[model samples]
Target: MTGKLVVGITGASGAIYAVRFLQHAAQYFDQLLVVMSQHARSVARAELGIEVGDGEQCAQNLLGRPYPNITFLN
Candidate 1:
């Protein structure tokens, strides 16, 4: 996938960084793929106060809205 951005969200201290990166990547890449680990959800809830469930729900929760070019990889 040329010019595509793949983001993996793990259990890191800076969930904000991932959020900001996604915002910026969305503007530049035509295709954006996001993979969120289970630990990432736990971190997000603790750090960002966001509870992300599994599968597409987790992706939808983080993104707020589904974009045409955005793909959620479970």
Candidate 2:
């Protein structure tokens, strides 16, 4: 098995930063744990216009690829 890492993203202006970081982290960790705040979600929608319907759909949008080592939590 490989190692893991945790990434927490709060309701900050730089929402893309978190996603971009995770995209890059895909190669570094076997498991990538992600946590996002309500404000972050709101900001993401407002800024990126990414209509992430439900939890599962939102998960797909954030990762932007197949279900890889990524998780989304509110």
Candidate 3:
């Protein structure tokens, strides 16, 4: 209940779901390690109109805010 969580985002059709899940998960988890696929960025842009960048910016782009507990993996 009070630990880390790993979330993976792929180039699937439902990016909004991932975004929403991450937002809620951040509130409960101590740390969030996010692994995003290479095509996920393109899918995010196409579906959610978000420009996902590298490193920390990627998190902000997806979540629309900065979450200190969330870390994006390369």
TM-score of model number 2 = 0.80
Q: Clashing residue pairs, candidate 3?
A: none
- Model 3: residues with Cα > 4 Å off, grouped in runs: none
**Which structure is stronger by TM-score: 2 or 3?**
3
Alpha-carbon error at 20 in model 1, in Å?
0.8
The best candidate by TM-score is 3
Deviation of model 3 at 9, angstroms: 1.1
lDDT of 1: 0.77
Model 2: residues >4 Å from true position, as ranges? Answer: none
lDDT of each residue in 25-69, candidate 2, tens digit only: 877789877777778888788877765545656667765775567
TM-scores of the models, in the order given: 0.79, 0.80, 0.93
lDDT of 1 by residue, 15-72 (tens): 8788778876887888988888888878888988888766556546776765666677
Per-model lDDT: 0.77, 0.72, 0.89
Q: Best to worst by lDDT, what's the order?
A: 3, 1, 2
Displacement of the residue 67 alpha carbon in candidate 3, Å = 0.2
Clashes of 2: 0
